[model samples]
Target: MRQNAERCTAALSAAVSNYVDIFEHVEGQIIHAHQKDQERKRNCVMMPSKKLQTFLSLPKKQMKKSLSETSELEKELGNYTCALHARLSPNEHTAIKNSDYVKLSESIGTSVKQAKKIATTVKLIRNVQKQVKKPEINPSKEFTMAALF
Candidate 1:
């Protein structure tokens, strides 16, 4: 009877120790993940203007080009508005007011631009997917995928 009790006590002690070890391992993983996340967040602050300028250091011609594209798009959009207004109705004394016509033209332009943006974003994602290198798995080494947990 004493031997049986001793064995039972030993088993119980081993089980408790295993549980404590697993709990500690999981706790350590959680702490590690949290610390890594906090470190990433700390490193993401915006750089100062001087530092940013030094980092960029773009050529003057390239900078001029970037600025010009903005004004050019604005002018092109204005031309679209002018063409739309001309086709739709006269400037003054029309059944539809000029403000309403301008608003309608602006909304149409915005929708067209949004559609283009969605298309461009999709294209970019597809391009990135194409560029990504997939690990080569030998067909002979392939096994049935594991069932969902």
Candidate 2:
């Protein structure tokens, strides 16, 4: 009878230890996930700036093509005041409103009305580029890290 009691006590202890190990593993995973989430949030702060820079730096032909593609959709939807237009400065608004179609068309390498739209889009992109702060990097710190590696 005493041996049976000891066997049962040992089994219970083993089960308790197993449960503790599982709990600790799960806790560690949760902490790791939280840390990853925080790092993602930090990185996302500069995502808009990166996107804006990429768009602005595109080749002129590619930029014009992108603007033309969106212009068709804008006309179909009959939505003239887009998010980009909404953010335009007063001067940009006036420029688009009173733009010389022939001059703009020749300069932008597009049709008359499409040239106006492209000009507006370019202005909006430049405005956003100005507004979005670029991430600063310390060259000395980067050099130190590279040296460590």
Candidate 3:
């Protein structure tokens, strides 16, 4: 049995010298993978700067676009509110104008105080719109969306 073990050891040593190194092959594969990983990291790192430049530039253009959209929305809201106010029957308008909070609240499906407050606010906004519409106004005098809120 000892002789057979010695022969096997000798065959293993011979095979090691005769064949490609298993450890070296594995190490090469590991190194190749590491290099691929580094290259991928490098490629990924380069992309963000170009994307950042575009991303940064977009806000300026988008700000202008968003501002215009906001203005359009404000205009539409004003027109819609004016239409709503106009559509109110004389009886409903009289109830709000008379400060009859209970009747207004019941009619509008809101709390007494809340209904009165909302009606007054809408009335004031409609008045502002009326004044603004008649004139080719100064920019400073222009009614902005901020005042509505």
Winning model by TM-score = 3
Clashing pairs in 3: none
Candidate 3, after superposition: displacement of residue 87 in Å? 5.9
- Candidate 3 at 18: error in angstroms? 99
Query: In model 1, where is the ten-residue run with the lowest total lDDT?
Result: 89-98
Alpha-carbon RMSD, candidate 3: 27.4
Model 3 scores a TM of: 0.36
Show model 1 residue runs off by greater than 4 Å: 1-4, 45-149
lDDT of 1 by residue, 81-146 (tens): 343333332322131332343443343333544434423333332333233224446665565343
lDDT of 3: 0.57
lDDT, candidate 2, 1-149, per-residue tens: 99999989989999999999999999999999778655543431111244344545677555555545676532422233344344334444455656655665653346887766566555655543343334446999999999999
- Measured with C-alpha atoms, the lDDT of residue 9 in candidate 3 is 99
What TM-score, over all chains together, does every model reach? Answer: 0.32, 0.33, 0.36
What C-alpha lDDT do the candidate models reach, one value each?
A: 0.45, 0.56, 0.57
| Residue 2 lDDT in candidate 2 | 92
How well does candidate 2 score on lDDT at residue 114?
A: 75
RMSD to the hidden true structure, all candidates: 23.1, 20.0, 27.4
- Flag regions of model 2 displaced more than 4 Å: 1-3, 44-61, 64-149
